[model samples]
Target: MECTICKMGETKASDITVALQRGELSVLIKNVPAEVCANCGEYYLSDDIADKVLTQAEVSAAKNAEVEILRFRK
Candidate 1:
C-alpha cells in the first residue's frame, strides 16, 4: 500500500516500536506489527492493533506510570 503521509513511499509489513505519550505519561511499546513507509519512516497500525496498544497505554496511565516500556504481546 502507498503511505498516506508520504506519497513518495510504499508501505510494507514490518515490526516497529511505537512511542505514545499523554499528559505526564510516556509509553514505549516494541515489536509491534505495522505497515511502515519506506521513505518517510511513517507507520500505520491496524484497528485491532491500535486498540490493543491504546488499551495497554491506558492501563499504564491508570497505574500512574511516569514511563513504561513494554513488549507487544499477540
Candidate 2:
C-alpha cells in the first residue's frame, strides 16, 4: 500500500519499535510487527496489535513505571 504520509513509497512488513507514553509512564516495545513506509519511515500497526500494545502500556502505567522496555511477544 502507498504510504499516506510520504505519498512516495509502498509499505512493507517490517520489525519496528513502538514507543508509548502515558503521563508519568513510558514504555518502549521492541520487535513489533508493522507495515513501514520505505521512504518516510512511517510505521503502521494493525488494530489487534495496537490494542495489545495499549494494554501493555496501561499495565506499565498502573505499575507507575517511569520507563520500561519490553519485547513484543506476538
Candidate 3:
C-alpha cells in the first residue's frame, strides 16, 4: 500500500497497539492490524477496527473503568 501522507512506495502490514480515549476512559489495544509507511513511519488501521475501538471506548467510559499499566521486575 502507498502512504497517503508521505507518498511512500512501500508499506507493510504490522501488528500494533492503539491507545483509545473517550471522555475520561482510556485503553490500550494489542495486536491491531495496521499499514505502516516505511518512509514516514505512519500507521493506519482499518475502518472496521477503528469503529470497533470507538465502540469499546464508549462502553469503557460508561462503566467508568480504569486499566492499570503494570510493570514487573524479573
Selected candidate, larger lDDT, 2 vs 3? 2
Shift in Å, residue 56, candidate 2: 0.8
Clashes of each: 0, 0, 0
Sorted by lDDT (best first), the order is 1, 2, 3
List runs of model 1 lying over 4 Å from the truth: none
Worst ten-residue run, lDDT, model 2?
53-62
TM-score, cand. 2: 0.95
* Error at 63, model 3, angstroms: 1.1
Model 3 misplaced stretches (Cα beyond 4 Å): 68-74
TM-score of each: 0.95, 0.95, 0.72
Q: Could you give candidate 3's per-residue lDDT for residues 1-74 as a string of tens digits?
A: 88888885567998777776656656776776778888988898778867775666566667778762211111
Query: Per-residue lDDT tens digits of candidate 2, residues 1-74?
Result: 99999899999999999999777778999999999999999999999999988888888888889999998878
Candidate 1 lDDT over residue span 1-74, tens digit each: 99888699999999999999999899999999999999999999999999999998999999999999999888
TM-score of 1: 0.95
For model 3 the local lDDT of residue 60 reads 62
Q: Is candidate 2 or candidate 3 better by TM-score?
A: 2
